[model samples]
Target: MVRSEWTKVWTTPGTAWLLITMVVATAGVSVLAAAVTGCPDTGCTVDVAKVNLTGVQLGQAVVAILAVLVVGGEYSSGMIRTTFAAVPRRLTVLAAKALIVTGVVVVTAAIAVAAALIISARLLPLSLGNGTVLRAAGGSVLYLGLIGLLALGVATAVRDPAAAVGAVLGLLYVFPIFGLATTDPDFQRHLQQIGPMAAGLAVQATTGLDTLPISPWRGLAVLAAWAAAALLAGGLLVRLRDA
Candidate 1:
């Protein structure tokens, strides 16, 4: 099942394109972020990992879109029936897609993040000593992979390419929009604590940890919960629905 799904993913034209898009967009944005910004004050505190990895925000959208197309495209093309006919196990099919999607996203995202940080290594202040840099780098990679999983689950549930893509993007951005529009501090903090983008990105912070709305690892856990819930919902729907 895994091999078949893997073949299906690689044979898809957009899979390579989307993965390329993710890497280029991530590295490009990181380069731009590093190029445009600098130390403005003497007592400056900036999260180098977060700054260098700013491209992940853009990269994640590409990842989500890619994951969406992996499943949703099958529905759009009426190929899902064929897939299920061959596999005969709905959950297995979804699991294989999820795993393949994660594997691709993780590899490309890791490369993107690594190259971004390396290229911009000169631009950063570099005062974040000890394991902070390692944590930030590792966490950023994990965050992108999880984002892909979240997108996969969403795509599996929605089953339509356009609608599933829209839903995934909404999940990534809507809470942040509401958080920005609201004036209530408590509400804003709550949104940040739960919003996948706001919370998951916290893992990339190498500075100002005390001021974060949610602890770094805990914030990541929130995202994990979101992803798990999405996948579970999607699996249920897949099991119940007609192929």
Candidate 2:
């Protein structure tokens, strides 16, 4: 069942487009950032990792669409009934879908993030030898994968591709915007500490540790928590509802 579903996903036009968008957007933004920015000699240079991965913020919308379409597409076409009939076990079906989607997203994100980092290293003045760069590069990939999973979970719960995609993107970006809009530095800092985009991107921060609103790893962890919670909620909905 898993293999069959995997094959279907790869063969699907939407999946192909999603994957291509993810790769292209990531690489394109990284290249642009590298071209536009220069590294500083004293303070932490323009975080090459962050620059290369800036596209992830935009790429995540594509990931969300893909993830939502994986399940929601079937629902929209009334094919989920057939899927449930064949799989029978609701939990198993959801789990299989999650695993397959996560696997693909993780692999693709890893490749995209790594390529962006390597390109940035060559194009930028910063030294790739720094441990912070390596961590940021790896973390960016993981973050993209997690965003995919979160979108998948939300889609499962919403059961509507358009709504799911909107919700996921809203969740990822809205909070960050809210953070920025606030005049209170403390509130903005608080939002940055907990907002998914604001917090998750913290992993890319290579300098100004003391002045940062939140620690890099902790911020990423917060985003992970949001993903886990969404998945848990979606799983509950999947288990309780009828197709």
Using TM-score as the measure, the top candidate is 1
**Candidate 2 residue lDDT tens string, 109-190:** 8877777777766766555678987788778888887888888888999999899998998898888788878899889888
TM-score of each: 0.95, 0.93
What TM-score does structure 2 among the candidates reach? 0.93
lDDT of 1 by residue, 86-157 (tens): 988899999998899888888888898888787776665453444877788778888989988898898889
Over 4 Å off in model 2, which ranges? 38-45
Clashing residue pairs in candidate 1 are none
For candidate 2, the C-alpha RMSD (Å) to the true structure equals 2.0
lDDT of 2: 0.82
Where is the poorest 10-residue window by lDDT in model 2?
38-47
